[model samples]
Structures are given as C-alpha cells and as structure tokens.
Target: MKSRKGVRAAVTLAAAALGALAFDGTASAAPLPPGGGSWDHVWKGSSGDFTIYVKEYGDVVSICDTKADGKTPTVWVGPGNGHTTQYWFTAPGGKGACNTKSSSDGAKYRLKRGQKYTVTGCAWGCNTWDFRDRH
Candidate 1:
C-alpha cells in the first residue's frame, strides 16, 4: 500500500544504519593474556588465638590476618612455581604481626599457598592489629 519511494527510502535508511555499525570502534572480544594468566591457591589458617591468610596474584603476594573470634591469624607465602619475589602488607594498622618473612628486617615466617602460618607480636587480636605475613 505504500509508495515505492517510501519503501526505497526505508531500505536505504536500514542500510545506512548497518554501515555505521560496521565502522564502530568496537571489534571482536579481547584476546587472552600471555601465559594465560597463572594463579595459585591462597592459604589461610588460624591458631588457638588468631586466624591468617595468604594469597598470590600474578607477581604480587598478599598476606592478611582477620582477627576472628578474638584470635590472631598467621599468614604465610612461599616462593613456589619458581616465584621467589613477593610483597607484604599489615592489616588494621597493626592485631596480628608478621613475625617471619624473606629477611630479618621484616616480620618473618614461611607459609605455602593453601597453608597457614602462625603469628607473633600481634596475637589474640588484642590491639586490633593484623600482621602482614612477611615471608
């Protein structure tokens, strides 16, 4: 029932809309990163007076002590998978402290991924301090 010009105009408009999409900046989904991104399991454990956790992301390692049930947690990180370098952080300003780490200058201790480490200096979450599992 519509005029041929109207039909032709409608078709032209649709084609133009599709053409605009073809030139859009977006393309196919991004490709995966090299090495396909490797990740190791995090380790966490708690003693009679505390709880601790250790995790590794890429080249970075994080240790946390979530003072739970009035217990201080001990966290640990081990140089595994040929990974010898990592970092550290203390939680809640200071409830659990890292007693052992890579060197004598830092809170020191050894902990493997999926394993838990005991904490000292910051125990029982008494002072609301969380120690960075330095090792």
Candidate 2:
C-alpha cells in the first residue's frame, strides 16, 4: 500500500510539472502602445526582437522589428482553417533599422474579418502565436 501511494504521488507531481510547462509554452497578447490605435491583438516575439500587431478590425497584420540585433525579423501568417499556405512578411533589420511592414503595405494579401490566423515570428528562432479578427 505504501509503495502504491508513493508511485501515485510521483505520477501526480510529474503531471503537474508537465502542465506548468505547457502553460509556459503558450503565448499571450502583449499590451498596446499608448494612443497606437485600436488593435484586435498583438504579440511580441519570444526573443523580444519583434512584434506582430493585428489592426483595422483584423483586416491588417503588421510586423515590426523592435531590436537592432543584425537579424531580420520575419512573420508567417496563414489561415487557421487547416490551410497549408502561409504568407511571409518581414521588416528591414540592422542597426538603427527598426521598421514595420504590413500585409497591406504592398497589396500582398488582405486578411478577412472573423477569421482565425496563425502567426509566427522569427528572429533568433521561430515562435508562433494565434490571432482572430475582431471588429
């Protein structure tokens, strides 16, 4: 009986640890800038080198390179409906080259409202975040 209880306790502890790790791996939206306009959602890269902002009622998505680490910041956006195609957006990166680029900047693509999209940011590595269009 004592051995069984010990095994049960160990299993419970392992499960709890895994739950915590899973929660940590999930990314949450970042706070918007002061007077930066209404944004449906925003996310900062895991490496703190870039930011992704969804705005204009989810009709536009913007990628900004926030750091001057000599590495370009890129974002991949795709439909959340299990679609396989993804569009890439990137910002100019270099020392003193913090800039923002958007999907609508060059008429690349337009996002639809009320649609879910998967966004991934790449700098040192790649991290993914999800955004849903909101009016």
Candidate 3:
C-alpha cells in the first residue's frame, strides 16, 4: 500500500509538471501587445511571396500589401462583444507594388476604444490575431 501511494503521487507530480510546461508554451506562442496609448503593428507572410501588414492605432487600422502575387491582402475586423458584424479592409494600388489603405487615403472603418476585436489578415492564406482598443 505504501508503494502504491508513492507511485500515484509521482505520477500526479509528473502530469502536473507536463501540464505547466504545455500551458507556458502555448502562452508564449502568441504574446499580446502592451495595452493602450501606443500603436502596434502585426503582419504575416514571408519574402518569397507577399506580406500582409496591419497598423493598429487607437480606433483605426491600416493595411498594406507588400507584393502583387495575384493575391489580394485583406483584413477582417470584428468587435469582441458577441456582435456578428465585421468590417474589412483591402490594400489599394497596382499589382507588384506596395499598396496601403488608411483613414488619410480613402474609406476606412473605425474601431471603438475599450473594445476588444479580432483582426484577421489574408493574402496567401488567413491568419488571425486579437486586438483591444484601449486608447
């Protein structure tokens, strides 16, 4: 009986250690930006193809496409309040050139401060990230 109890405790400790390691790895995989009062940029893709870049500042987001590649860079923004409405943005310009869209250039959507939103970028494929408007 004593040996059985010892084995059980060792197994539990090992499982707990493994669980902690997994959680730590997952947390480190996607790190959030610092909250409020600053701008943050998030992007996806590589130099071999095209890159989709997003500049988020306060309630505004700007998207840029780095290559032509026949793939259009797009951004999807949705407010995190259980709302189904999502706004989108696309880079504007000719192919094989850098195209950008922001409030200063043309039509753009505005995010609400203090609201959390999911931003997804797509050029070759789609990648999603979360952003909170704290400013």
Against the true structure, whose TM-score is highest? 2
For model 2, name the residue pairs that clash: none
4-112 in candidate 2: lDDT tens per residue?
Answer: 1111011000000000011112353322332355455566666677666655432555666656578887767666732443567576744223334344455445555
lDDT of 2 at 81: 35
Question: Listing every candidate in turn, what is its Cα RMSD in Å to the true structure after a full C-alpha superposition?
Answer: 25.7, 14.4, 17.0
Q: Give the TM-score of candidate 1.
A: 0.24
Candidate 2 lDDT score relative to the true structure: 0.49
Which of the numbered candidates is closest to the native, going by highest lDDT? 2
> What TM-score fits each model?
0.24, 0.58, 0.51
Candidate 2: C-alpha RMSD after superposition: 14.4
Stretches of model 1 off by over 4 angstroms after superposition: 1-39, 48-57, 68-88, 93-135
Clashing pairs in 3: none
In candidate 1, what are the lDDT values of residues 1-135, reduced to their tens digit?
212111101100000000001111355222111122332322233233322222232123233333334443333232332133233334332323222223323433233334322222233322111222222
Compute the lDDT of residue 83 as modeled in candidate 3.
42
Ranking by lDDT: 2, 3, 1
lDDT of 3 by residue, 1-135 (tens): 112111101100000000001112334322112222223444444332333334443244545454446666676667663244456756545233333344344334555556676655666655555556544
Q: Return the TM-score for candidate 2, rounded to 2 decimals.
A: 0.58
